[model samples]
Target: MNHIILGNSLTDWLIALAVAVAVAAGLDAVKAILLRRIRSLTAQRASRARGVAVAALSSTRLVVLAILGLYAGASLLALPERGQLFAGRAAMAALLVQCAIWGDHGVKSWLASPRAQQAEDPGRATSSAAIGFLVRVLLWAVVALMILDNLGVNITTLVASLGIGGIAVALAVQSILGDLFASLSIVLDKPFVIGDFIIVDNALGTVEHIGLKTTRVRSLGGEQIVFSNAALLKSRIHNLRRMEARRVVFKLAVNHDTPEPVLRALPGLVEAIVSEQPQVRFDRAHFNGMTAPAFSYEVVYFVESADYRVFMDVQQEIYLRIVSMLAEQGVRLALPAQTIHLEGRPAVLPVPLPQDERVAA
Candidate 1:
């Protein structure tokens, strides 16, 4: 038992190995017991913190815990400087990676809370998704740096090199980067969201998806239109879904021969038709002006509903009523016609002589 092996007595080696195994077993038992308790709590009443704890604990690999135990036991041994350094670095790397895993789980659980899932408030949902992505990237980046530092890497030099290389990469993919940032802006600014009916220039559609590079819209024609996020942000966007009411203006024309009294009563008649319609507010009706061939009246009203179908139905009903009213009043709609006066005698056509008469002559 007094014989030395690797600078330690055989008995000392056995003690160290026994301690490593004991610690590993203890950690495994503890992890299992804690998991059972937390899971029970989760089943009783779910919470974001508890959910994150479950996810993080589940990600802790048995091998990582065993390595940690071995490192603890090795600390008591009289190992060489290099062996000690290697063990310490290995343990530290495993710990950093485990912490990163926990952080990742926490971020996902936090972002998936009820507040973040509100579809009615799309700005919050979009912001949460983007924020979660950025946080995970930052978390992993820090973990990588810490691991590299433990391995005795000179990070300052590496970071400076990456900076120069990053510039080159950025220039190569500037347009893609522009679109990514534009997508970020859309999430933050929230000009439009999924299910919003919007018009971008001549293209009108409902937003279906917003992505890093493009935004997809389902058009009225049932075709999907894709727009680059950068270009989409540049164009003017009309979010019709946000409108409280639709303003409608229409013009009516009556023949020039209409009676003066009938013309005077036309405005009130049309106003009555509009006011009687459901979901509409009549604004004004007036004898606008006399055109070359007819008298024109302009009518304006508002449809209280933002739905296009509702507006159209209301408009159609009002028009039909107006036509019926005009018929009752014995008024005819104007038609395009032109009148001209002869300032000189009208030209007469001469009759053509027959061919036989010309031969006899």
Candidate 2:
């Protein structure tokens, strides 16, 4: 049968069909082999690159391969000029779409890989969600532009229009856009992360979640506080969780008439008390000055812990020991007192006296 259809003989049409099917089946077989090999390599070495390759290959659809095979078959035919051009464009579009799929799979695989999960900085791992989403968006946008270009579209003018429109939209939602960018900066710069104890101005809390628009903090008072990312970044943040040690300074007073020897020994006694406490470093203790009511002394130390509870416990123990030492040394803690003289009369004392006259000699 020498009859021709669409400028190709019936036998030629059959041969092209056979080639298309054979090519599709062969490609599918090769994909299976490559996938298996790559998976084995990924399992053995735990490499993110190899794992991404395996995922990308796994996403290779049979339908896409069939479309590619059809495009290859079309090359063997005496197609019209328009038909040939359309076939080439269709093949290119398919190829671009397949590449986009592979890229998407690779990005997701890399984000979920063991290496990412095991990163030393947990901020990097947590930031992967936003990073992956952005990478996929760019991948698809580029693929779409490539397809449009392949179809003989004037993408340059289209891209220019999109840029103008994007600028207009950005201005319209500038507040929202600011928050988004601020969130990106937060994740990348990592001033604080989830579970960090932070004080933003006066609001103190543990960071619960970081989102594109806001960050949620669970406050010490058991209420949830939400801060807009843009506003949050503008405020001063004190990340207490990162503190290596906590400094403590306290003041005590002694009676104005205490013996000089005892007053001098007081600093050394306070130093010994602070040094004996666990997780504490004694900084200094001094009789700084004398006030009208008492001789004031200041003591300073550092707790080698960021935990508030530990600091409080160590401080309580030190205070109790200081009181015991003062009692044993017969040091009287100063109390406010005053003496007044009535003309031609004994001075009237304001200081409290137990079972004694209200007037002073």
Q: After superposing candidate 2, which stretches have Cα over 4 Å from the reference?
A: 1-3, 114-120, 335-361
TM-score list, all predictions: 0.88, 0.87
lDDT of each: 0.90, 0.90
Clash-forming residue pairs, model 1: none
Count of backbone clashes for each model?
0, 0
The worst-scoring run of ten residues by lDDT in candidate 1 lies at 114-123
Q: Tens digit of lDDT per residue, candidate 1, span 1-361?
A: 9999889999888888888888888988898999999999989998878988888888788888889889988988999999999999999999999899989988887777734556677657667777788899999999999999999999999899999999999999999999999999998889987788999999999988888889999999999999999999999999999999999999999998899999999999999899999889989999998988889999999999999999989988998999999999999999888677678887889988899997887
Which digits, one per residue and each the tens of the lDDT, describe model 2 over residues 129-175?
77888889999999999999999999999999999999999999999
Q: Model 1, stretches more than 4 Å misplaced?
A: 1-3, 114-118, 339-361
- What TM-score number comes out for model 2? 0.87
**Residue 316, candidate 1: C-alpha displacement in angstroms:** 1.9
Instruction: In model 2, state the lDDT of residue 45.
Output: 79
